[model samples]
Target: MDDRTAEYLVYLDATLTEIAGLARRGRDAYDRDIAVSRACQYNLIRLTADLERLGSDWLAHHPDIPWRLIKGMRNRIAHDYLTIDDDIIWAVVEHHATQLHHALENEIATAKTTLHTDEQTP
Candidate 1:
């Protein structure tokens, strides 16, 4: 991966951490009717943009991840925010988190290692 992809990968991983914390913020989101979940959902959308912006090289290697659904989710949030389903967000938080977490963490660490290698080479 190139430098920008590495930065985006770090962003993605940090966003996942934020999502995981937001998931645990449950009821708080429901009680005050907090927009935290919605905000976290937006972060997911942003992460997808980061993915898209990373371009073909990143996508080619991580083709197994849901790039399309992610983009769609972002569109839904941006254009159809009113009908946003809490359950779907919850499900993504519960199930998708682990899968995303693993991938993001690995990609970020690999990127960092490569960056370090490049620095040492010079």
Candidate 2:
């Protein structure tokens, strides 16, 4: 893998960890507190951008993920910031973020293994 890809994997992992912590307060807390909700949404926007920067090759390798939707979400959150639906954002936080986190963790592990193997080659 390229150095940029490795760097992004590290960033993605860290961002997801932060998001998970942010959402640990659960839906009620998230919904009740505008700060928590906005924090989660902001990180998601960053996450989506990071995924896009990971390049087409990285994305194509992980076809199982909803790349377009992820990108679209960033746009929605940014463009429709005023009228953004709390329920949908909460759902994305509770559901999709966890899924994406796990998927990224797996991809990072696989990439690390491959990198190690390459280094070991003659």
Candidate 3:
């Protein structure tokens, strides 16, 4: 895989990890924690950029994942930042985190395979 692709996937992976880590803290008090909010925002931005920069084509081939909804989340974060609802973030952490993690793990494994093939070709 090219560096850009790998980097984006890493961004996606890291964001997923951040969300899961946040979920472990439990949700009731988590919504009020400043640190947790920052981590949530940070990953949202990272994943947003990854989707925006990579565009829909890459995601199309990877439709086994929720690429479209993920892109929509990024859109909400990027285009509607001022109206972001903390409750939505909380919901994502609680519900969507596991699915995204599994999807990204598969994507990353495929990228690694591509990287290995490219290395052998030269």
Candidate 4:
């Protein structure tokens, strides 16, 4: 991976970590607290936006990442906030975010290996 892609992956990993932390607060807090829900949404948006910055070529290499669905969610959150469903957000936080985080971790590890290999090659 190139430096820019590596940077974006790191950022996405961090944002997913933040979302995971918020998720640990549990469903009750998420349902009752606007702050918790909004924080999750905001972090998700940030995560998706950074995914966009990873560039098409990099995104293409990782076809399993659900690039379209991820970006669609970001658009829904950014452009249609009022109609956003709490249940969907909660589902994403509880399940999808965790899965995505794991995938991101793998990607980060691969990126590090790629960088190391590139360094050694020269």
Candidate 5:
């Protein structure tokens, strides 16, 4: 990964961490607290924007990540806020965010190792 891609991945990972913290607050609080929901949405938007910065080629290399769905969710959140469903956002936070965070962590570590190896190769 290039520096920009690596930077985006790091940012995404941190955003995921924020989402994970929000998720730890549990479902009832998420459902009752508008703040929590909005926070989750904001972080998700951040994730999508950063992911887009990674570029399509970088994204294509990781087919396992649901790039289209993620972008789609961002579009929905950005363009149609009223129609945004709490259940789906909650599901993403509770079920998917951690897994994605782990994936991003691994990717960031790999990128660092690759950069280190490249520096030593010359």
Candidate 6:
């Protein structure tokens, strides 16, 4: 991984943290409160953009991740904000988001170790 990919991974991880914080209020609260929903959506959008910045090459290595669906959700959240359904978004927050966050954390650690090994190689 190059410097930009590493940086973007950090950003994604941080954004995931923020999303997690925003989502802790539970689905009922999120569905009832537009502010909570907006915060989660905003972080999720940032997360998708950061992943996109990592580009197709980086994404290819993690084929198991639902990259396309994530990007599609980002598009829907961005382009169709007015019709954004709280239930679906909350479902993503409660289920998919945690899985993605953990996966990204593991990937970031692996990438850092790989980079460290690469640097040590003469």
Which numbered prediction scores highest in TM-score against the true structure? 5
Q: Candidate 3: deviation at residue 109, Å?
A: 2.1
> Which tens-of-lDDT digit does each residue in 49-108 have in candidate 1?
777877877688787888888888788888998988877767777568657888667678
Off by over 4 Å in 4: 110-122
Q: What is the lDDT of residue 73 in candidate 5?
A: 92
- Report the Cα RMSD per candidate: 2.4, 3.1, 3.4, 2.8, 2.9, 3.1
Per residue, candidate 4 scores C-alpha lDDT tens digits across 1-122 of 67667767777878888988998999999989989988999987998888888888878888888878888888899999988888888888889989988877878887667766777995
Q: For model 5, what is the alpha-carbon lDDT of residue 9?
A: 76
Better of 1 and 2 by lDDT: 2
State which candidate, 1 or 4, has the greater TM-score: 4
Kindly report which residue pairs in candidate 5 clash with one another. Answer: none
Model number with the top lDDT: 5
* lDDT at residue 52 of model 6 (Cα atoms): 86
Alpha carbon lDDT at 62, candidate 6: 86
| lDDT, residue 23, model 5 | 95
Candidates, ranked, TM-score = 5, 4, 2, 6, 1, 3
Candidate 4's displacement at residue 55, Å, is 0.7
Clash number by candidate, in order: 0, 0, 1, 0, 0, 0
Each candidate structure's TM-score, on Cα atoms with residue i matched to residue i, is 0.80, 0.84, 0.69, 0.85, 0.86, 0.82
lDDT of each: 0.75, 0.83, 0.72, 0.84, 0.85, 0.81
lDDT of 3 at 47: 63
lDDT of prediction 3? 0.72
Give lDDT for model 4.
Answer: 0.84
Q: Tens digits of per-residue lDDT for model 6 on 10-48?
A: 777778778777778888778788788888898778888
Error of 2 at 58 (Å): 1.2
So what's the TM-score on candidate 1?
0.80
Give residue 63's lDDT in candidate 5 (0 to 100). 93
